[model samples]
Target chain A: MSSVAVIDYGMGNLHSIAKALQHADSSVAVRISADADVILAADRVVFPGVGAMRDCMQALNETGLAETIKTVAASKPLLGICLGMQAMLSDSEEGGITRCLNLFDGHVKRFAEGLADTEGNRLKIPHMGWNQVHYKPHPLWFNIPQDSRFYFVHSYYAAPDDAEVTVATSNYPQAFSCALAKNNIFAVQFHPEKSQTVGLQLLQNFLHWDGAL
Target chain B: MSLAKRIIPCLDVDNGRVVKGVKFVDIRDAGDPVEIARRYDREGADEITFLDITATHHNRDTMAHVVEQVAGEVFIPLTVGGGIRTLEDIRRMLNAGADKVGINSAAVFNPEFVRQAAEKFGSQCIVVAIDAKKVSAEGEKNRWEIFTHGGRKATGINAVEWAVRMQNYGAGEILLTSMDRDGTKSGFDLLLTRAISEAVSIPVIASGGVGNLEHLAEGIISGKADAVLAASIFHFAEYSIAQAKQYMQARGIEVRL
Candidate 1:
């Protein structure tokens, strides 16, 4: 039986993600584990997190899962969700610019304060709610339609130095990279577990993906 | 593109079953809470709010089970409220698969609970539900007052001021409900809804008195609410969530269509 490990680094809604994965494909075995052995042995790895970058990095560093994640990223298909996506970058501006995993060449940035649309109405921070995701050809976007709506709830977003890694973009008044992909790694700023139908399709795609670029 | 204005269908669960009533009285059984939630999700509900009206310790486990079941089938965000008093309670709900936990009476009685919950589990998962009623007592200017205990007890706190306080205390969103307009279906308390929405920077979900799709649109255009929550209209299948989204989309409001 195929097994997928959802890394639990003392952050994120591990239960919700695990349940969503099982629901996405009932045959796949989904396990929420922090142990390195469990993660390495699984056919795929999903890194999911939320909250401040400082605490996220703190928990990851303290638990030594940082090294385990990097080790697994080299061979297996790895998917990062929300903060997990941001953490894959070099650093973040949150909490006085904390450094991140640096798996991909990028930086996480906070949405500029006082941002507004053309109508001059101030946009709320956290960018909470559904926004359309425009994607390029990729395995994760296999069956999902173009410009599909996904749920997003974050104040900061990933800005990769190399635009080649960007797989999808979304507009929060301005376009930002919502999904990034390089070789075996795939990451998204939106919450697929909370994104309904299209999201489940993406998760299902990830389950069958072979970690190819 | 702008953030879509959300239309949330709320399920008032009592002992694991969905129930609806007028002004929180003469309650009638609607259906299974999880099944109703699943239906709303498929029909294009922006989100779902589950309020445990019974609020008893004995039924807490049952509520969690319902949340687990709903969370498994429904992919949209779920906010569970009622009888949430402590941080542990919030943690329990989130662990049980709820995306967000809505605190009402506990937050009014002890404002610090809001701060602590926000601090512990990011504000995104912490929603403060305020049940407010307009006070037009002699010599006092018209002001909405906060009510607790399922809108039975009144607190002298000003609704708008309390909303601001909750935002300042690190609440990510405010679920503002008008007690007077709740079951009346006359229309939302636009005055009260607008007051709280304008008072806080965080997202405000206007609740109560939604009789039709136009009322939902008014909640966004007139009340300035980021989202609108309704129970009866949806519970009885009077109007599907897709119809409401189509109505709002026609009115130039961005909805997930």
Candidate 2:
């Protein structure tokens, strides 16, 4: 039986992701594990988290899961969500400066203090709520309609150095890269677990994908 | 299209059942919280807020159960509000699958608690719910103050100032409810909504007194709310979420249709 492991590094809740994975494909054995072996042994790994980059890096490095994540990224079909996606980047500007896994060459940045649309109204930070994700052809977009709206709640966004790695983008007044793909890895700033039907479809696609282009 | 303005349906849950109390009183049964949440999801609601209005200590767990059941099937952002007092409470709700937990009276009693909650859980999950009532005399310059105990007692805290304070204290978003217009169905207090929304950089969810689709649009256009929340207009089948979205879309409000 195929099994999927959701990395639990003492950051963010694993309940939603685990449940969503199981809900996506009931046949897949889904487990939330903090142990390295459990994740390495699984067919797929889903890395997810929330909160400050400093704190997340603190927990990950302290638990030595940072190394585990780095190792897994080299060998498995890994998926990252929200802060997990940010963590995949080289570093972040949050909390002065915090180095990340560096699996992806990029920096996570904070939305500027005063972001306004054409109407001159100040756009709220955290970029909370649903926004449309425009995607190009990719395995993860298997069944999700192009430009489908997904739930998002974050203060920072991934800005990959290599634009070719970006597969999808979303606009919070200005376009920002929201999804990326690079051999054996896929990551998103939006929460697929909380994005309704299209989200589940993406997860299903991830589950069936074998890390091939 | 840009980010769609969210249309959230507030489900006041009491002991596992969905109920809507007019202005926080005159409680009446709506239906199962899970069922109502599912219907809202199917109808294309941007997100769902389950306000646990349950009073008894023993019955509080019912809200978690409701969230757990809904979270498994309904794959949209679910926010649980009402009676969230501590870090443990926030953790419990998050563990049960709530994307966000709303803090109300506890914030007014101890402002620092908001900071602690945000620090521990991250501001993204810490939503400070503000219940504001207009206190100024009709002829006088407009002023609103915080009210606790279901909007009964005035706290003398200025509403707009409180919103900015909470945001500074690390609240990710503000759920602003106009006490005067809550159940009156008159409409949102555009002035109050605009004041608090403009004061804070965090997203403000304009809630209370949503009688029709136009009111929803007004909340975004005039009130400047990042999102608009309503209850009875949806709970009683007065209008579906799709209908509300269409109305907002027609008015060029940018809904996820």
Candidate 3:
């Protein structure tokens, strides 16, 4: 069995994430251990959450999983999700200014002005429900569609400093980064786990990633 | 870019089991609500609304345990309606892992319930449900009146005005059901649906009278609804959300397939 470790840092929605990985035929183990060896030895590590950015980062710091996560991300495949994805950015505007995991070079911010003056395009905030994701040119674009819908439930989104890292984009008010990929690290603004077959395929692709350069 | 439309699946629960009937009679076991919910979650359902038909008569709060179980298994957003009358009801639903709460009779009796719940939980968490019947007359001009208590009482309030009032009261969305067309399997009331959709700035979910995938697509396009919700077609496995979405995408509607 291919052992996949899903880091549970006092965040919600771990069960569904684990179930999704298992559905993709990967053996998932929910882990909160600060022990470096356990994380370092896993085939892949998934960081998942469904809560405030500050509380998640706090849990990571308190459990000392922060160092374990950093160490593992440098050497192995590490995936951050939702708040976990936001935590990968440099910082967030949620709950005042706070430091994030800094796995990537970016800051997360709230949607501006809540009013997009586009004709017939009035939408609510939180950007809840399914939206189309447009893939940028990258190795991660192997089997994903050019225009596919993914589930999104976020109030703030990633604003990466380096444009080159963005692997896919989606338009809410205007186009924004939906997924980022740089070396062994990748994150999506949308929840692939909840995105059904297309999402399952993404997970399968991640599990079978050859890291071909 | 045009705002993408939503496709939602509604499950009607009676005494913890999903029951199906025509014209709201001769109820039979449809399926387990949790199983059906998980299937819809896998079928790429945009969002889910669970309506507990017996909630008021049973004298219970909203079905929190079911919400908890479904939330544990499914990661998508869940909205629970039925017997939601107070702020505590909204809080309970949210605590049970529901992302949004739907209001009907409570909002009809007291519009302040809409304002209060929206204030307590944020406007995005509140959904005002309206059951409407068309008033047919030349001067009536495609008007719809709101119905309450399982479509038993006619409020005589114009559905469009109520939609506008709910929008002003901080409702994030509206679930409009056509009482006349419900369970008839004809198709959604597009004229009445369009009127409510046009009157409100918030997202509108068109419910009732969806018999096939084309109805779902047409509901979104013709009715100008953000989402088209159906019960029988989905409950009886006549069509899946994926199939409906594919049909919509084929018809040039931007659906997340």
Per-model TM-score, in order, reads: 0.95, 0.97, 0.73
Look at candidate 1 and tell me the lDDT of residue A151. Answer: 94
What is the alpha-carbon lDDT for the whole of candidate 3? 0.78
The TM-score between candidate 2 and the true structure equals 0.97
Candidate 3 chain A worst ten-residue window by lDDT: A113-122
Top candidate on lDDT is 2
CAPRI-style quality class for the chain A–B interface of candidate 2: high
Question: How much is the lDDT of residue B222 in candidate 2?
Answer: 99
Q: Stretches of candidate 2 above 4 Å error?
A: B20-30
Provide all candidates' interface root-mean-square deviations.
Answer: 1.2, 0.9, 4.2
**Local accuracy by lDDT, each model:** 0.89, 0.90, 0.78
DockQ score of the complex predicted as candidate 1: 0.71
The DockQ-based CAPRI class assigned to model 1 is medium
Query: In order of the candidates, what TM-score does chain B achieve?
Result: 0.93, 0.95, 0.92
TM-score of 3: 0.73
